[model samples]
Target: MDPDSVSTDNILLPRNIEIIDSKIVNLSIILFISGYISKVEISKFSHFRELYLLYIPYKFKLLLRGSRDGFTPRKFHESCDNVSNTLTFIKVKGTEEIVGGYNPLRWESSSSWGKTNDSFIFSLKNNDINNAIISDIENSTYALNYYSRNGPRFGNDINIENPNSQNENYNRIFCKKHHYKKKIRDSEEDFSIEDYEVFQIIKC
Candidate 1:
């Protein structure tokens, strides 16, 4: 072995990836809606799809009505991007915490408001982005998972109101909201960076 020879290790990843202004190839339509990023090879171009990104309404609110197209996950851009076995975060920072659950709304629609082919994209019909599934990450006050909120009451069509008096339902989940008996200091000193990171996610 040559003593002068040096070894190099690539350490620029697995922390947080950033998007430089230059790499904005195809503008992401469902950028916030879809979750992560992955890579794949096809016959020709390095095509991109709804790879990586997952449905965490914290990013959006529970904008849709049901779960992932009937409580199922689909491959957004199959042949082109070919990203599989990827982990998506419903959390998008303020801290490293993430919110988790099968996004109840995303699965209800085609997950797409429209249709698409190779070199382009589109939207699904009735593109109503008014999120019903409010969470602490989005509203930052209250939240309940699909199981917690999924009942006959939640399925009722939204009734928006601006009452003249003090009698109006403040569109919410859990009939009420979480009343914590004690305040948990989020920045607990004994926690390792990664420990607190995972703990922060609201696991549904």
Candidate 2:
């Protein structure tokens, strides 16, 4: 062997894998509601680095009655861009059920809502508050037409303010208002809700 030949063993190489330790994100949606962001427990399965919290006031949530419709508030478009997962957590008013779901898609402001083919909404069923089930993924689009403010105009047949109406009977999760005046069927993807705090899970 020639003494001038360089030894490959002495060559330095870059690391191929960067190990990251799991840590809790300091983001607090509760802060906006209760003026606190820490100690906000979330399901461990919510693997996110950053979270944009949106608090839906109970007064505003009262309008979520009736069928499922797309509902967006004044500042709803503030976080509509980018690819992110929407995690909604609802606390039933008259029951002990704390249920919500995750929509794996970007909230778009386009003509209609743009969604990924892997869209799904899951709920925290009994005996498993942290582990939610994948309710559905067949529909590429879970969120239909979007509407801001009071939603679409309806006839006298529907009483949006009636406490005994289905709207107030079964509190639905925080979602958008639609353009059409029809009942949004509660399927696997469309789960019922009450008072909820929505968060947009984002990666750093």
Candidate 3:
């Protein structure tokens, strides 16, 4: 069978593979290659999708890639500001951990706090979906922080500090327990990221 010619809609899995939930499985595979970054896997993305609780099917449209687009606050805002319903995926450097947040409100260059109860932060384990951890917003008023000089900040919990140098270590991306219900990362110390991607969630 020609792999490239096989359409996602009618593609068939091996007969030996068990079909527990076909819809979720299919959606996972389709969305994984649909312009989303390579760090997030099918199962992990599927779990993230379930967290949204949207009635209609949605697709992730890549808005910005930190490595490809540049890891600066100015660059982030230029590409992502004004775009609503964005899902960010950050690959932690030197670890199998992938942490991110979902903002239902539009990102802005002006400084302000975005209020929305639908926002959430999460950590996905690369090998297992069951190990994923999701932290819901405890305070809607501080759900998201939009600043002209910083990357995405989820209520001071998961903050991607504006890069000041070319070295990844100076980026200082960190996660701490704050407005969210719980901490997504095991530690509250600052860390660096391998790469990150922001996607606009579009309902179809």
Instruction: Please report the candidate that would top TM-score against the real structure.
Output: 3
**Candidate 3 lDDT over residue span 15-131, tens digit each:** 553312221123333343332322344444443444322322566678887778777877888889999988787878787787888887999866789899888888866534467
Model 1 bad stretches (over 4 Å): 1-32, 36-46, 50-124, 127-136, 145-149, 152-204
* Better candidate number, 2 or 3, judged by lDDT: 3
Number of backbone collisions per candidate, in order?
Answer: 17, 12, 0
> Of the candidates numbered 1 and 3, which has the greater lDDT value?
3
As a whole number from 0 to 100, the lDDT of residue 39 in candidate 1 is 18
What's the residue-level lDDT of 188 in candidate 1? 23
Indicate which candidate wins on lDDT.
3
Tell me the tens digit of each residue's lDDT in model 1 across 25-74: 11232332233211122111112221222222222222212123121111
RMSD of each: 18.0, 14.6, 9.5
Model 1: weakest 10-residue lDDT segment is 192-201
Q: For model 2, what is the alpha-carbon lDDT of residue 83? A: 34
> For residues 71-136, could you state the per-residue lDDT of candidate 2 as single tens digits?
333223343333345544554444444343344554444435444444333333332433433333
Model 3 clash pairs are: none
- For each candidate, give its TM-score against the true structure: 0.17, 0.38, 0.72
Model 1 C-alpha lDDT versus the unseen true structure? 0.21
